[model samples]
Target: MIVLASQSASRKAMLDAAGIAYEAQSSDVDEGAIKRELIGVPGGDVATILAEAKALPVSVGVPGKLVLGGDSLVEVGGRQFDKPVSREQAAEHLRFFSGQRMNLHSAAVLVRDGITVWRHCETARLDVRQLSDSFIDSYLNREWPAVSGCVGVFRIEALGVQLFERIEGSHFTVLGMPLLAVLAALRAQGELEA
Candidate 1:
């Protein structure tokens, strides 16, 4: 089994649905501080960097065992959104994204014995349909608690699916893991069945 260096429910669901064996644990790093220090870095690169930060820590604990870390971020008009800070912010994200296209960047890193081994990043484009103020309000009321933990304030597999009109990318990438690539990497490393 691999060590999943994140406690995100979405990531856990993705792995569980894939029948992948893993242990979930938090890296406990301050992601906000990393973002602040990397000011002006592109969203995709930031995601890749953060993935390594999480994976490296857990790899240290398990010695030679594989440790996986992943992160997802949303980019709208060059601005990146992390999980919402409040219900108001979540609503604001929806308002700005209404009738616009946003790119969701998901990245994963694998490490062994505290050394980086492999990494992958994938991007998915989502077109959010025009949304009315009432819809935004009701959406936050029903979904904020659940979605607030997700970047873009969405969990595309849930009510969040209603917010999008079109999506272009791998389904798993949008769900926040480059899962197929990750599986391929694991198999390549002799950690999973070939």
Candidate 2:
């Protein structure tokens, strides 16, 4: 069995949908501190770094088990955006994203006995349509609860899909878990059936 080190519902849904069996456990890592430390790194590398950080500690605690950790971030106009803390910030992010292309980078790592066995990071670009302030207000009112948990202030699985005019890359990448690659890695490691 694999151990999932994350509290994200989207990630759980991804694994469940893929038929990968995993025990969910929240990995306590100081993400804010890590983000601060890697302020100048590329978005995808930062995501990979955070994912490894989450996996290592949890893998150490559950020695010999397959522990998977994942992280995602939005890079727009050369700036990286994490999850929004408030509706206002989400609204602001959407406004800035209006009619622009933004990259969603997701990274995943597999660790066993505190050793990283596999790692992958993938990037997807979303082209958001121009949105009006009124639309933003209504969208926020409807999705803020679910939206705040995701980077880029959009779910892409729910009404958030409507926010994009076009998307380039894997759907799973935008969901904050590069799941297909992870699945392949699991099979290679003999944790999942080939």
Candidate 3:
């Protein structure tokens, strides 16, 4: 079984649905500090760094077991967006994202004994449909607190799908992790059947 270093529902659901055994553990990493430190870095690389940060700390405690960490970020119009802090903020973000191309960067890392053994980052491009104020209000009314945890202010597997007009990338990537690459890495590590 792998040790998961996040409480994110999407990542946990992905592993659970894929039949990957894992135990959820919070990494306790300070994400805001890391993002400040990584100013100007590419979104994909930032995701990888955050993933590694989460994994390395957790791996130190569980010496032999593989610890999996994952992170996702959203970049639209050269601006990086964090998870919205409020319903109003989410609405503002939705307005900014309207009719814009959003780049979603999802990354994952495998660490054991404080050493990273594998890392992967994938990017998904989503063309957000033009959003009207009424549409944004209605969308957030139903999706707010739930999507508040999402970097893109949306979740692809749920009502969030309505926000996109076109998407060009792996479905798993848009869900917040590069799950295929992660499964492949697990197979390579002998954690999963080859």
Candidate 4:
């Protein structure tokens, strides 16, 4: 059976929508600590490292089960934005993203029997329309609770799509799991019927 080492509702929803059978378990790894340790690495590489870190611990305990772990971040210019720590922070993040194009990096690792069987990073570019202060405030109030690791202030599945002018990437990657790449990896490993 496939085990998903994350508590992300979006990831679970993606897996379910694809009709993939899997078990969900929260890895509960200290993500802040991992990010801090990887501070010296490039932002994209940091995302990959964080995903592997999350998957490895779960894989070690599950014996032969295949475990999937994922991490996503928003990178603009050179800075990486982690989850917002407060409403104010969320608002600030939205302001930074206003009228700008940014990159979203969603990285995943699939581990089987304590070894990484496949890995991928799905990068998508999003153009945020010019947003007013009031819009930012309202969006933060409405979306902050639902959005945790999301770099942008809005949840694309919800009202968040309205905030974007254009999104150039796979829909699944923008959603956070990159389902196409995951499917390809699974098929190659003979874990899924193609």
Q: By TM-score, is 1 or 3 better?
A: 3
lDDT of 1 by residue, 29-74 (tens): 8899999998899888999999999888778889878999999989
- Tens-place lDDT per residue, model 4, 127-192, is 989999999878767777777556566679898998899999998888887789888888887789
Off-target runs (Cα >4 Å) in candidate 2 are none
* Top-scoring candidate (lDDT): 3
TM-score of candidate 4 on Cα atoms, chains taken together: 0.94
- Cα lDDT, all candidates: 0.90, 0.92, 0.95, 0.84
Q: Pairs clashing in candidate 2?
A: none
Model 2 C-alpha lDDT per residue in residues 1-194, reported as the tens digit of each score: 89999989999999999988899888889999999999889999999999999988888889789999999989988889888999988988889889889999999999999999999999999899999999999999999788888888887878999898899999999988998899999999998889
Worst 10 residues of 1 by lDDT: 55-64
| TM-score of each model, paired residue for residue | 0.97, 0.98, 0.99, 0.94
Candidate 4 stretches with Cα past 4 Å from truth are none
Q: List the candidates ranked by lDDT, beginning with the highest.
A: 3, 2, 1, 4
The root-mean-square deviation over C-alpha atoms between each candidate and the true structure, in angstroms, is 0.9, 0.8, 0.6, 1.3
Poorest lDDT segment (10 consecutive residues) of candidate 4: 146-155
1 or 2: which has the higher lDDT?
A: 2
Model 4 residue 147 lDDT? Answer: 72
Candidate 2 TM-score, true structure as reference? 0.98
